[model samples]
Target: MTTTPMPVLEELSAAEALRLMAGVPVGRVVFTEGALPAIRPVHFVLDDGGIVFRIVGAQRLADGLHNTVVAFQTDEYQADRGDGWTVTATGHATRITDQDEIARLARQLPLPWSDRGHMFRIEPELVTGRRLTR
Candidate 1:
């Protein structure tokens, strides 16, 4: 069988990054537990110039809620040539517990791909990304 060629890889600008983020609904949240790092896929929304999502029964994730400094990323990948685009945003996350805040954000974010949702908010301090086109 013949294989397809890979697309060119390019760096995405800040504007492009934000635009790309606006289109996607899921991303990975990276955090550290003791010495090891963990990443989990989460459905999120871009609101108030930040990221917000709900978590159900994530104990480890609940621990990370202590601080806002975290790494959130979204990307696309292909196995054939291992080509894709990934955008990583380094920022702090805040657990929104206030009833008013939750209600407001809830109105803005419908629901994630999961049945039970735990809401969390993240504000990016630095954003960097690369795109690989085939």
Candidate 2:
């Protein structure tokens, strides 16, 4: 039997990574709470230099009580061929308390997968991405 060739991996530029992230509807958010790490899958919309999302309740990370530095990751990968890209954005997360801004973002972003009452925004200081090519 013939074997498939090894896949090559490449790093994506910050702009390209952001573009890829905007095209997808879902991703995972990682943060630290106390001495442990936590991760949550979330839906987001890109806005200027920040990414915005909505949540239902106090998730500790979103409640403005835990660590502010977090990483938001989005990717699309094919298991069979191992071809696709993954983008991770590191930044500070803060809940949007302004009613007007919330209204504006609500109109721009797609409806969240879950029932969420609060909106949050994260301004990424660094963004990195990687892709596998077959």
Candidate 3:
């Protein structure tokens, strides 16, 4: 008997992925804790090649929401060809401490979610993506 191995996702073009992610309004934010990984869906935006969002007292935020590298991904799927694409942005997150900068960023990117969420930013070092092109 022969066995087949699962194929890993091949990387997509950064530009294409960014375009898709920019158009989307939400994504999954992934992080690590001890030997386990945790992920949560979040509303986000892309600005100046970075990801930004607000979270309201979530455990993920309480655990560690600053200066840590995390992965952010967004994707969409259709019935045909199982057509879909995903973009992952790996970056460091930090609380926006500067009032002026916060105000500026706020104007460009408003927080559409609840008011309880605090402003956080992720500056991505490497952004890659993949899509099912049939």
Candidate 4:
């Protein structure tokens, strides 16, 4: 009888986790809506040790997330090799209202959707990551 090898799980340092997060463009933002948990997939950029993303016509979501604790997660998996890594950042999210900052971020991170939207930044207080290796 053949036996399959067990996968090993490794914890990543904050710096390495952040580095991995920077390599990905899309992640999930977890927040609360109507006192219930909700998650949205968004295109994001790692900037100055923070996560920046935009939302369009989502006033309720923006209001709910602004100045509130949230979680941002991104992961990459290689099914063929059965190895992958996932990173999660938890922090308080704040809306960006400055015109110049908004313009600069728009230039730096281009989103796939329309330009009209609100921008938010989440300065992570806790960053955790794990890698699964075969």
Candidate 5:
């Protein structure tokens, strides 16, 4: 019997990681809630090397994220070919309170969610990624 070869894992550069991140629309945001770790899936867009997303007002996740260090991750997999990549960005997230800026992002990103949600931008301080290939 012939054996299948193992997939190769490769590290991606910061620019490449961001490029890959921009290709996906949904990602997970990790933060703290009630002194414990909490993660939520969010629809996001990559802009100027930062991750931008939305959350409804007065949410525990939103309240905890402002000016806070958090991790955002996104990945894609192809099971038939055994190839995929995952990118994680760690940074401080800031709520977009500027009406003009929020308006611009609203015009640009057009997130498929409630319009009343607040906008947040995560300026990635550390970005890392790995790719698996057959």
Candidate 6:
């Protein structure tokens, strides 16, 4: 007879969570729209202790929602091995309009997938993550 080892579920430290987040370029940004919870997938970069990404100026996301409280989440999972991790960061998001900062971020962001050109930043106030492994 044989028994499979139990999988371990672990909570990653905040630093580790942030480090993991830095490596991921895609995530969901959660927010409230018309009093309803909403989420949008976006490409992002970790910079200056914040998450920065761009959207076209005409997008709904580019509407007057600066300084809104929001959440950003990223995760990876393997169904076959049941091994994966998830990271989430919550904070207030603000539009970054400084030309100099935008230029700096332009160098860091992946090639734009959309046509609009508004940039925003989120300074995470809380970060948490979990990992599962055998």
Which lDDT tens digits does candidate 4 get at residues 79-130? 8888999999999999999988888887777545425678999999999999
TM-score on alpha carbons, each prediction? 0.80, 0.88, 0.79, 0.93, 0.91, 0.87
lDDT of 6 at 130: 98
In candidate 1, which residue ranges exceed 4 Å CA deviation? 1-7, 58-60, 78-83, 112-117
Model 3 weakest 10-residue run by lDDT: 108-117
- The residue pairs found clashing in candidate 4 are none
Most TM-score-accurate candidate: 4
- C-alpha lDDT of all candidate models, in order: 0.77, 0.81, 0.76, 0.88, 0.86, 0.84
Per-residue lDDT over 21-114 for candidate 1, one digit per residue giving the tens place of the 0 to 100 score? 7778788888776667877788888887888877665676676564748888998778776687888888887887788877877776655443
Q: Model 1 scores what on Cα lDDT?
A: 0.77
List the lowest-lDDT window of 10 residues for candidate 6: 56-65
Off by over 4 Å in 3: 1-10, 33-35, 58-63, 108-111
lDDT of 6 by residue, 36-82 (tens): 89888888888879998775535566664588989999998998887
lDDT, model 6, position 86: 95
Per-residue CA lDDT of candidate 2, range 17-129, in tens? Answer: 99999999988878776668877777788888898877655665456522388899999988877699999999888888788888888887665542366677889999999
Could you tell me the TM-score of candidate 6?
0.87
Q: How many pairs of residues in model 3 come into backbone collision?
A: 1
Report how far residue 8 has shifted in candidate 3, in Å: 12
| Cα RMSD (angstroms) for every candidate in the order listed | 2.9, 2.1, 4.6, 1.5, 1.7, 2.5
